[model samples]
Target chain A: MAPMSDSSAATTLLPPGSLPLDELIACPQCDALFHARMPGRGQRTSCARCHTVLIAPRTNAYLRVIALALTIVILMVAAMFFPFLAVNVQGFTNKASILDTALAFLDGGFMATLAVLVAAFIVLIPLLRAALVIYVLAPLAAGRRPLPGARHMFRLSEDLRPWSMAEIFVIGCAVALVKVSDLARVEFGVAFWMFAALVVVIVFQDGIMCRWTIWKALDDTRNR
Target chain B: MQVDDLESTGRHAEPVTARGAGLVACTRCTRVWPMGETRCARCGSELHSRDWRSLQRVWAWMIVGIVCYIPANIFPMLKTQVLFTHTESTIIEGAIELAQHGSYGIAFVILFASVAIPVGKFVAIGFLAWSVRRPERLHPHHRHRLYEVVEFIGRWSMIDVFVVAILAALVQLNFAASITPGPAAITFALSVIFTMLAAQSFDPRMIWDHDGRGPDNHLTSETP
Candidate 1:
């Protein structure tokens, strides 16, 4: 997913005195080991071995990240409770929200498990991720020190990244909708747009937030 | 392992890391300072980047994903009702239905996203996990590339779920026609979530861990 990084130029050179192995960060992609150095606020450094972005802290990234996370939290709630789609076919009409669709499977035993899983994938994990991001980044955004276990919280958020499937759900829905449009009277609800917007915001948040920058901020604040 | 080993002694048997090079590079930022540097001078980040237990997590998640995939295929992905008639279709059945109706492209998209990719990932991750230790003549870099490619495509398999969400939202024809997600949707989503987790858990760096100590590490061999 991290296809961005420019390492065209030569890496810095200066192999100095003995340092503990813990001080070195090896390139996960290419195993290129270079000394760690922070770039200026506007500048970024990429791994010389793989050219993966190492550190590029944008000025307002914390604030922007918090904002996007909050938005997703709100979107997930609305997506769950609100009516998702309604269709009318020759004097007959049926409508269901995301929650209702999930609950519809509850009539069966094992299906109930599926229902719970769907609800979790479509709603819970994303909500949890968004909430975690806000909790970890909000203090930094407000110029206050990160709360206790902020490092753990941020790592949790990052680890949860791939498991949060809202955007994928949205895109899958779009493709499915294309196929369904030919069969019925399709009507996208407000919740659908909410989800659609959530995808863009989440992607933007991921792009803007630098893990190194955030970790550095947390560590600095804690050490202070 | 030393660049000097190759130049000064004509011996490049060991990896650059194995040479006891007192240098560590920041994977995030290619800043090279002394080995004792605790943080990246440019990015203010902790220099440690090795994921010590990557394989264990990858295998765990892969098993979980495979387990969840069981119900995903057995249950209906969606239920379609048309003028007092109801029809439920599992993902494969739905795709076949679309193919029957000449929506071959959409059907293929669904099939590939829902079936092929998830199963492919299961195999791919297993392969990568196995091949990392067993020194294959296949270019090690190509294995690394495979891991990257899998990581990049992880979210794409969710297209089937996305399609369901979209159709569920859009295809509502009151009493006449409607499409609702079935039990399989959630299981499918879970499988995807687990697969993604498995993929993320895989350490791409392990692709470079060939025991062969082949010189091919520097020169990428043709993909076998």
Candidate 2:
């Protein structure tokens, strides 16, 4: 490479494209120069040295987004209404749903800011992002133009994607379980299973599906 | 000339002649070389070398770790217990519990660092890798941004692990309560570490491969 430049730095920030058979590029992480042989569009590739994953080109973008959207909706419903865990102690038993847990915190007199942040980031953000992705993808898949607010929705989803925090919730649960082990009994609940499934779906969709197809569709749309 | 020499021999010698010459220095050895030669006569080492590229294996591991991440989050990571009673909680339940208990700040922190950031990272890395595999030149801006995002967020995934560690250390009440890590802790930690490694291993140079020009030229020409 000639030398680092301001414009090049800016250009580097964009996402990868969906074209096939590209030359190998340097590792963004280490600045190590190398070549990669493209297998096909949307196919996953790996860095030879550090083994970082590279995604393949976009093909069939709309279908993937729709499926993910549906999955997100189902998981969100399950997470909200279902019992997340059951606790039993000294012959007394209790089960808590996601909403119930949030209410419990409110009952405990937590600050309003904390409560809102937790609800929005942990529950609302992920759901909204998933929904937005679906919304954007559905029209694109049908070969029709997105609605007037589609761009804004997509932007919102992108922004929210960073703030959604589900894994932290899992960690808290583990800590609570451990601390409470001597005092009471604990049981798995439907909400817990549903939540786990939700996380899985989110990861899969964000990591593989959305990045590949949705982006390609967006690029094509932008070009058109 | 013979008559002049004989006359000079009796008196003085002819004036001596003097000449000037150019000197060359070897970049490696600092030794002088003939004025016309290109190669270093002594060391024979090349004057330049390219930057190191990230290995493809790192990306492969990232892809594998991402795949495993799906199951890690999906499956019941830890089974909780109290007084011989057991319960299972996923990441979502933990957040809800925190929210319910008025520990919304902690809950949101954990949620963002562990859940949202990691998932976002996976998607970003996957997209970059996929783009690298394509022949089409990616938008230079997006590629750079993806690199920064991946690197910046990779460390946040440790929020869950940190929370676990903090709780395990802090929640030690003999006979009243005790906190113990579950099987999922190890898996979760591994997933985070693996994804981080994957981010570290990605070669950003792959972004420029589509331009079909040397990185040096791109860098120089693109400079503002």
Candidate 3:
């Protein structure tokens, strides 16, 4: 990396004797730089070196992402209350939900933290991310200035991307259900299907999201 | 090889990094700013051409991850009580038992997500961190790809922990049968979290900083 000297300068925008900084784009994955170009609708710009999608702004993408985010939020809430799985052995039957599983360790002990973490990983983080996306994009989707702190909220959602593991949780449940099927009769509950759909929705939302578009929108409009 | 590939694309003969042009991109919003800028005006996030302390943070979190991983493997992941007998199984033992029961698919998923992925993450993150300093040991392009894979797969290791949680919650029968998370579940979760932090703390930009190979005039004198 070039030596980052001149630490005394506090100006936020200073392009000295070069192309304007706003016209430059760097691939997040491989750090390959490129002169920024707005892709046509239904088109995307990928890093030539590593093929990471750098810019992809589809028409009405923000609105679509908002719709999907709403679905994630609704499904996650329902998945928490409804039974996730039911086990029957010799007429004895019990059903459990995601909330139940998360609180299973909360009766008091070091495990209480684990319970909270489980709830956070599967339920809380995803919910928060969806909520943040909606908050950050709702105004932008409506052709208005972003709500105050939209930039920060968008960044927060991006940072939490890896921590949101609802999809992994669903796969884990599938594996656990199979493992337990041998011991007893196991049945998927309504919440299981909801979680499955939630996974699909989450994946679709993430795939369709174009971070550059959102950032550009946030930049173009000054938050009120 | 990377240069040749970039050239074949006919866009540029080689990659041009933001830092090479005396610019910094916001980690959150991907907005490029001049090198002197300390924060992104668009997103209000701190900007750095490269995080100088990234490798140190990577090693610190990696050590914690490794420490938690030791107990995660040694202790039982789940405990089950049936009738008057109790059985406990660690992660690998549970996978093996599943395999013996002919649930090879679930077993493989468990083994891959729980064992192979985590171990691979530790190794990959370690190598990435180590290779940053000794850049000549591995091709930077390959290292960059490895870094991406490690970041993407680190969270999936939570599969085993989720499996334990779901099984414990679903198998709660009054006296005939019951299952609960063992001591290892929390440790395993911690290991996954720490490893993820380790991966996140790593600055991938360091991989490209070894030489001045951008589209701009190359700097013959190394910064450091």
Candidate 4:
């Protein structure tokens, strides 16, 4: 709390072992560093310089995040096979699912990679992240020890966070569907709603879960 | 001032550091430690000052993104089948179609999300990467802000791909009317994925590596 302002652009010296250096935290955004002190449940700690939320612990966050991750898995699986859309126009009607849409690109060799990449980002990455989240969180939520390789699983999940594009896919579809409405008789399928629900649940999961809290929980439980 | 005198004065108005006093902050938990300390005692994370391969990864991913982006804009994004008559539209054509149909709102959104954002991201990421290598081009703070902007807007670039997914999913009326994702759908998604990866591969901490030679640093700050 020593005048933690962005104007002080230079990082101050940490006196050698005079104060425990391990107790400090650096603002990830502005590089202005601060002392590290975990916020209690229902409290939030933000970077003093950039205001990025450093930690915000919530009660029962683990349980809620786990629940949402499970929902994403179910919704994603259902969204794959279930008809995502059925447009009927002038006596011709066709239904398509997410898998069908992704596979449609697999016409030739070069396109095959495209199809796989699309499918991986929109479907596989999300599903994988959700599964990893569950694997990492469920044991901690149950007041049990961290699962085997929980650290690696957690790291992988964090790394893949940006790669999971399921929510983006659904929002993009909504905008696109609005544009296509005039051209065809478009109808939302079960998978569309499922994807929609999955998005909401995922947002909720992200909101509830605290990265610092979970990591602390995992680390504490590991050596016990 | 002596270290003890400064502490006793309690006006401790110096910059914080991971480099000062032989200290390093944990990237995950933000805990500061002695420079030689390999592990963050609190979070059990390997502590490092800056990722050594950040620029390398950023350049590699940007190359892939640039490569994929060529095909993304060149190919048709969506194919519309109306009454057995097929029509293919690249992203620009689709936006033009939307504008012609008087859905200007959707059209602008499409253009903004598809073209403007992606191009902006490429430029921003390139600028950031360049700034890291050549810090004299722009203010380090401004470069850091640009990096944040790139990271924040990364997901929104997928809007075009999403629209494609939605239309492909919802507009299925057999021969009368149906939309299939064109080859560009996959390419565009890949471009977005690569750019995102590029942004991620960049370590923002490098932005502050200005060595005090940064132009106009003194002009911005008013010493209190």
Candidate 5:
């Protein structure tokens, strides 16, 4: 199962010294160069191209600590309340927030609840990651170097990023909404809207806006 | 020969460099090539150039898709009807119905995969794009880390599409209860597709653009 075809081999070229910071981690199996984190002094990370474990650079320690804290908070919130959405059809209406859904699954004695639990991975774990990033960056931003924990957290977040499933939840909702329309009467709820908003805000605040800048700021502070 | 010179000129005229020139060493034969070559002179492995424009375009589309997504979820993505009576259903509504019917597994899966994941992706991607646009050069590693996050999570955004497809295919009772696609379904699907495109279009190499010198020479020296 080759990822690329044989004849479509025309390649593009780049100039030397044009992208100094671009790191290449090779997949041991395929010998392909893919972008990856720098190996830590003693730690090993897997290659994105082949999933081969390799030694890479260390990440900041405080970031992990902060991420852990934030993760805990988000998890607590997700556990306490329903995430979003409720459905009504044929004189019967059922509702569950994110938390309610979890409990429902647990009580229902269905192992499939694991899928739902996994979905929260993005929502809850990223919160921890964000906290870890803050922890690492805040002191670094203030001109202090992070300890080893920051590096571990950085790696953990990187690994976890792909596994988070919040966006997928939204997709299922859209699909189900379409299907359920012919069968029942469905209505939107406040929690649904709030969860939607929360997803947006969380992405805005964490993914694009917050973590990188703080790290960059910390990097600059470290250089200074 | 004339065309080659012209192509080179055109390449040089462009603001970005081709990705091929960035590979310092061949993964297959360990042969190093100048950043300006299209193939590993030794093994003929195709090379890549650095082009952030695709990423930028993807970001723009993702923003638009996310905007559409919000409305798609909020404004009753679908209208449901049983026997000529109609009701509107938001994302959450559908999930609730599944839960109440003792299908807690399906219900939670719907909530997380369809509703939550898509929104999270939008936020995460949006944040990553904005951070890239910033002039700061610190934390190049972390920026790369963020790019990995966005890229890894990109596919999970499709969970919604999968759910929709699955339910639409499987859940057909006809009259006693039937499922139908809605206006928002198209929009939601587009949102997922666009965001996925955005993720694909985003060349993570752009994160290293700030360090525009070339890969670290120490990469080879440090490897065992």
Candidate 6:
């Protein structure tokens, strides 16, 4: 594929009677086709039929996404090690962090797999995705070409999006807290608030990330 | 890529798709490639105009997910020992216990995420797979929307599993009181993973490529 020009218009020369195939885009959700047009910065192009956001090029979106990703990585690490909650009942008190809970399942049997999965889904996957995002976006944000294997790392990050369960884990923790509130005196720890903030940052990062804009930027710079 | 210029170019009455134009779009990056290209030039991922095996893979994964869901419901999800009073509760029982404690909102969230969403995904994905074979059953727009919802909500089902992990981790006080994950946690996690795979295996493009006047029309007629 030829490098797209800096202008928000198709640059590659079209062959005779070939339908300007280079300028066409198919909606990922409904397969409806549209002539690819870059909306003005801060505007969005959505599929007509399904309303799926097609292209949204925000000013400095890359920098913001990278910043949020870095925050997620920091918060996730802290949440894993720092105490998450403490339960006190009948003069007995015990505190546990996320890592402590996940490892509780490690009894060298079927439960060991659960331990690994809990660690992966809530902590490992989210952290890896954040790191991959930072790795892929940092150079791009600084007006340099993406690092080597940028596309592969970006693809892996997107693939792990659904599997990253840190936000869901926070909601789960809230439910668990309420479930045990009557049984014990539960107090939130430093890590609990950090996790809450981490969830908000993650949501904002995902919202601002326009895949089409990122892919176009990557392709344009790589070809140069 | 100029929006104003594209608006002046006029629009087609019927929706056109990449497959109908003898092209393919990368599922990950949405970059278009000619039908003859086996891999995306930009992303280096395989390109297929239509994955003919999509439905088959969906069915296989969905069946396994359903089988695992059965065991997930029957087995206990959490085991609690409170000063020699042992209690084992399945997923529904846990939710009910929460509701009985007047934590109605949290209970609803748990029940909705753990039960309603998973069952809804199975039904929605099954309908999408069945409808693709006989496309006239439902409108393509609605089917595509259903697919989007299924893909979006599949991850939230992990909330219950995370709650179990957090509870098992936090509620430990030696012989006084403790909570541990039961046999159901792993089966439930597997079910969610399998169903997610089933959802991902489905190609939303198939919703628009109806029978008879389908994707092969342009290729067979060669009328360009």
Top TM-score: which candidate number? 3
User: Second chain of candidate 1: TM-score?
Assistant: 0.77
Better of 1 and 2 by TM-score: 1
Residue by residue across B134-179, what tens digits does model 5's lDDT show? 5253354455565666665556655644454333332333444433
Over the stretch B69-136, how does candidate 3's per-residue lDDT look in tens digits?
99999999989899999999999999999999998888899999989998999899988877665566
How would you encode candidate 1's per-residue C-alpha lDDT over B1-224 as one tens digit per residue?
32222223212232343113545455443334456667765444465434546778889989989988998899888888877999999989999988988888878888888888988899889988766555464566466667877887877887776577556645656666767778787778778878888887765655554322222333335324
Query: Which pairs clash in the backbone of model 3?
Result: none
Residue-by-residue lDDT tens digits, candidate 6, A12-35 = 112223666546676776565667
At residue B193, what lDDT does model 1 achieve?
Answer: 79
Point out where model 3 deviates above 4 Å.
A1-17, B1-13, B210-224
Candidate 5's docking class is incorrect
Q: For residues B1-224, could you state the per-residue lDDT of candidate 2 as single tens digits?
A: 43333333322321110000122332222223334555533334222112234436567777777776665566554344434555666666666766777766766776786688878887778777655544244554457667877876675675564354333433333434434444455456567767877775664544543232223333445433
User: Model 4: DockQ against the native?
Assistant: 0.38
Residue pairs of candidate 6 with colliding backbone atoms:
A9-B1, A10-B1
Q: What ranges in model 2 sit over 4 Å off?
A: A1-42, A45-55, A58-61, A107-110, A210-213, B1-224
- Candidate 4 stretches greater than 4 Å from native: A1-22, B1-14, B29-48, B133-142, B169-174, B209-224
**By TM-score, how accurate is candidate 2?**
0.45
| Best first by DockQ, ranked | 6, 3, 4, 1, 5, 2
Q: Once model 2 is optimally superposed onto the true structure by TM-score, how far is the C-alpha of residue B141 displaced, in angstroms? A: 19
Better of 3 and 5 by DockQ: 3
What is each candidate's DockQ, to 2 decimals? 0.28, 0.04, 0.45, 0.38, 0.07, 0.49
Candidate lDDT values, in order: 0.67, 0.53, 0.80, 0.71, 0.48, 0.80
Q: Give the fraction of true interface contacts kept by model 5.
A: 0.11
Lowest lDDT 10-mer window, candidate 3 chain A?
A1-10
